[model samples]
Target: MSVHILIIDDEMNWIKTFSDILIDYQVCDAEDIFNATNLSDACEVLRNNAIDILFLDLNLGCESGQDAIQGLRAEFPNSTLVVMSGVTTGSIPLMCMERGAYDYLPKAMSTDELVLSIQKVISRVEHFDRVRFAPNDLSMVNTQLPFSSYVTQDEKLHSVFEYLKVVSMTQHPILITGESGVGKGVLAKAIAEYSRPNGPFVSLNVAGLDEQMFSDTLFGHTKGAYTNASSQRTGMIAKANGGTLFLDEIGDLSLSQQIKLLYFTQSGEYQRIGSDLIETSDAKIVFATNQNLIELIELGKFRKDLFYRLNTHHINIPPLRQRIGDIPLLIKKFVHQAAEDYAINVPHISDGLIELLKSYCYPGNVRELSSIVYNAVLKSDGQVLTFSDFEFPEIRDIESCSLNAEPETNDTSFKRLDDLFDEKIIDALRVSDGNQSKAASLLGVSQSTISRRLKKLQI
Candidate 1:
């Protein structure tokens, strides 16, 4: 599938340069790559042909490209518009996204960024071809692979499920990122089941592995290739051929290992450790990570290009805190699973217990909730699972901290929901030692958001 690109800009030289790179990468031929001086011409080109990507220069001399974004998006919903700007000042990139641009890039970005940007849109275009969902199905829930096995009536997850269902159609790499225990692996398996049900689903955790180990595990070496290579062993990629290969804890991958994985993703080619023989596998790669990749890229711990590559179909699962409404459903599922595992009767859940469970913030997320329920099931001899069955170390710590919270100022005991939230924020701040930036990161929010909350609460 050749990518049809339309570069809408006044600069002839920039179009020439960009089109040349696309040709070099074999994204499309010269004839297929169209150019337009302005949005009108761009719209004409889009209307004339099925343009996969529309690269609009944020500057159009007299015309404001930012102002035209919403109109362009409305007129050409299928064409993915990537807004490029000369001005990289505050909130402009965010504004482009808000205004319906698929991606935003600075005009002065490196050749690498440009290539990655183009690749990102191409990835989406390929996704457009693969995705079978209609627009009306955006709110679809309670169906599909992962959702079929699990139970949830949370409104927030409706969008997540629908998005995943669409993304699962694409053969390109899918990146599932979220806080820990948000079921990234489960979604990856669902992708496999939905996309290629008969194919194998192989998973590998790359948390503690070094470069040599990572390569050896992902790409098997031939017999006698290494010290312990007495027999030839197949790697996860080979094992998952024609299927899905899930790489968990991908954030822990070192910079060098990231480069290797990036290359494999780009080319679908790899060579086993100490073996000159190159191999290719059609294993659909699925990556999961809890770390903030963009921050890691800024800190030079992660590659920017790799980030874009894996972000082809990024599916971010909101943590348990954001979707607390699903606690009852999740609790029910966990309880049944625990009872089935123990070969015991399913204990009754009290409304008071539900309230108590919902009050404590789940730092460990759904995984932690399951552990609590399972452990409680094992301990309880009666018919009901009570509040004593659950563990909330943070709640206990907060209670202790409230005694010393503003000891010199005011005695603010947690009472209302607002107070509980404020206490949570204060606890995060204290844990981060009054560093607002660190506190924001700990709370999984922006520093500005925390600042606003602090000001509003007068804390």
Candidate 2:
């Protein structure tokens, strides 16, 4: 898609020249914004389009263009603002900087300089979007693709979900561990949503955190505290104060950093680097990892004390291989997702193909399965998903089956209500690793149900 550029220049000749230059560089919708003499008019245009870059003139007729830019900057903060003018006043650039103008460009500069400035602005904006979720766009479902809606009929899967539902009501830290593609992150998000349905939930992988970036990203730094710090910033931990903070790949944390994190878990207090005052953080913490921390502790790579602190509520996500019966539902969901993403009609799946998928051992688990469906959607020439769309290794041994069970007649047996209830409660406890609230979500029941059941069962 072409980048949307909005130009606000009073000089008609300059506007025309710049529009031509932007068009030559493959930018789209390079429209004159000087027609928007007032903030209200500019805002109307901004609201109408997806603007990637805004070029604002420093002076509009009878109004300080800086003030107008400041107002537009507040409303369209995600759109990069580049100050463009024939007026070479230093104060204008400084003022625009204070109002969050992305960069300054002189009208007399060559086409190369203009294009380079735009490229730099685009790069910075993409990075900013990755780290920051705009409030307006936070809840909007991405129209490109849809993901699987969790389903449960298997006793083991249902029990785990029930446990997650219950533990989500509390503010305690939750630790989730499982093989990759086992939906550890998905489970973490489900817990966050249950805890604070109306609040923001922020997530990031802590595996890349070194000492400095971790501090700045989590606790936020004040202006002038660091060499390049230009403004006071809110960190992820601060941003999610009333909600939840999901730290994926927590097992990758270094031992020393784990000690630092332990302090936050212990006392709900944090201090920005180069600051003496301690600020309290009240966000619930959810950590996930595919690695076994016990092995890390054995090798002296992980801190035992920090592990215990985070282990107050634990969850273990089961791999897809253990839940082969779910493959059909998962594949159906992925096919619909692919159809939506690619703007194509949803294709039907054959029973032969479904049986073939169930027979194969998915090494990458659900993630791999989703990818296969996505590819099949793009490659399938017919309206239905058939075995021809798939390529698989020959079935080797009965032991090689994903479920580790011999192929037999479809089992539709059921337990008595009492036995079913007991089994579900126990399975919830196992998946939650004994965390009651998280167990509740997995079971599609309220925390009270699990609590009351536990009381009756005396578990």
Candidate 3:
């Protein structure tokens, strides 16, 4: 994408060199006051130039670059401003970025670094575009505590959260399936809160555990079981008795451990590592995995019986790309939380910036979002985060549809059938207060259809 960049510096030599380095992009320069007699004239130049980006020097003669940034931001809200300065670090760049500079660069930067920064800015803008315009249906059930400061506008995520509230009320084992960083742990914790607010909520990542350790850690030993067993020890399952037990990456459990887990799940009973006697714990089990268990079962990596047992009540999280609409909401939520955590003011988001985030595929999902916002907040140093804080991946390798184009297929075609589908379903569900059968009947659809559609669309 060729972006029109406006250079608002007074140095003729540096401006010429800067424009030369930006040969891959379109650069417009205002080298001296003669080019723009006054602030109004400068604003007029920016207004008429149809500029996408601004490279403003810190010293703009008697007029400071700070004033120009503020003026241009007010005049051209869509333009992404870049603050370039010979002076390193301090309040000026912060003020510039806070006022709405897309990025800040040292005037002495190498041609390569300068070009890279510009490309990064362009990539972010593109990513945001891909996510902002997609449609979704978002709902808020009773917000649970430890109330996931993790933000996502993704309708699918909201629905998962809503379903999590209801599923949390039961002791049925929950199988959470998703790609890594889709907030499975958050969902598990939310379920734990729902099960027993005051009871113990213990979580174990079963990924690295061996057979003996897995059994021992889950079911406590009664003194003298092993060489290290100097005294009786309570395991996580026992510790979580009457509460929730979360097993993360349960797909990583060995076959033997899977059998042991299945036995306990089936009968609510387990045996410690060296004990013959059976012990029972009434803890609710919630397991999460990024793996496809069906494939795992077919490959003989995961046990079929265990998969079925854990999947009694399942929650599959959609990835970031599927829920593009959630990008801005998540970004806004993250910015606010980051500002609060860092004791800084919340930053403003540019429309182009929003479009940039939506365009990229967040392979790391919501966790990536948190990291990006946190880093951006640190870089901003109390200023608003610009496209500069966000580092985009190489765009040449990404698929076009995942970047700039609208999704060719709306797999959730049921949503497109009619707007009434949403209104009727939501209205019935609300009036019935989450009675599936009643809601289905009210909508004149079979209960099975309602269940099937909800499972398919994950709403």
Candidate 4:
């Protein structure tokens, strides 16, 4: 289980001193240490053993340090390569990093600093291994909602998934913000499944909860606390102890309610309704919202202090329109799921239908697309689905607008044409509820084009 490290340097004294430092600091098992005076011997050692970390001296007498990086990387792709040299001029360190070196250290650094650098690399390697290998041993097999079910082929989404995996290992409070139906809640659940698989996962929508209701729901209520309280009750914080407590629609919370929630989060203590006893919870807090909290804070609807507290670790889920590559995969998954739920055969989707689905700006995001697919499948009699089964009201409106327009004839008609153009733009804006991107989709134009027209027309 001990880490294996290889030191490649031509200087015997440097190699001996660094090896002694590593061994004395218990960086890894002393027997696991390997040394090579040049790239040839280093490659041979790499071929024979798996080196977790490789310390390569860039200034090897007659040899160039940069020349060895590619060869070492080719042979030991998994090893964390650290370039060290007495020469600190030029872009050597940057070049090493660009060529995939884990870190660069100066040979003049003290032993303590060298130990710290080695420790940092080891920590990162261990974290990566933990996250990478966790899926096999974690409670993923027992959970109904597996991480793989979140259908995404986009590189950005994959990176987001990786970030989520790394952050899930910690108990930091996460604030997830995005447009409605962008799957913030789903991501939160995925985090909980990975981070606290054995513990309970509780959720609550804090939108409509007044101060009293928020308190009763989040901090629990004692017997005879209110008109409907007949017995003792446990709230979400208590129920989610040792696990995750996801609060959806967090932006809708009242300012007073925000203060109370912030107090609980800051102090980890809360008082139940009708009880003077203070209680503490160990639940991991995950908050999500569709609204812009900064705007709300500027408008005095949300507390600034609470916003600062919750903004520590924030993730912005990109909307479906932004990640169009994921549309087809999501469509297929939703269609199959719907077919299974309806006890019918899975319907075949056409390439044309998929293309049409990709063109539209899904304002309601993934949830809207899922609903469209499910409805089409239910209404379809044939095995293969076509565009006829899909009802896009926005598309119809755009078509109607185009069909109703008349051609301008002369210079005298230019004024009328301008008026008509303004009317059409206004109509598109109205159809899209003032969302310029959605309006652009409705008009079959780019968002930038819409913005230019809006500015030119002075609308």
lDDT of 2 by residue, 401-447 (tens): 43654323233332244554556566656656788775665544677
Measure candidate 4: CA RMSD: 13.0
Looking at model 3, residue 135 earns an lDDT score of 46
Full-model lDDT for every candidate: 0.77, 0.69, 0.69, 0.76
**TM-score for all models, in order of appearance:** 0.67, 0.54, 0.55, 0.58
lDDT of 1 by residue, 1-459 (tens): 877888988889989988888888777899889999888888888899988888888888788888989998889877888888787765566566656777878878888878887886787677656553454444555654446665567775675676677677767799888888878888788788877788899999999998888988998888999788998878888999998999999999999999999999999999887678889999888999999887686678888778868875677787776677888888988888999899888987765456546655566778888888898887665366644455443333334333123112233432464555576567667666788886665444578978988999987
Candidate 4's residue-wise lDDT over 83-145, tens digit each?
Answer: 988877655665665565767789899989989988978876686667667765433332234
Off by over 4 Å in 4: 1-146, 393-459
Candidate 1: Cα lDDT at 410: 32
- Score candidate 4 by TM-score against the native: 0.58
* For model 1, the run of ten residues with the poorest summed lDDT: 400-409
Model 1 alpha-carbon drift over 4 Å, by segment:
1-81, 86-101, 104-138, 144-146, 396-459
Deviation from native of the Cα of residue 178 in model 3, angstroms: 0.2
If both were scored by TM-score, which would come out higher, candidate 1 or candidate 3?
A: 1
Candidate 2 segments whose C-alpha is farther than 4 A from its true place: 1-148, 391-459
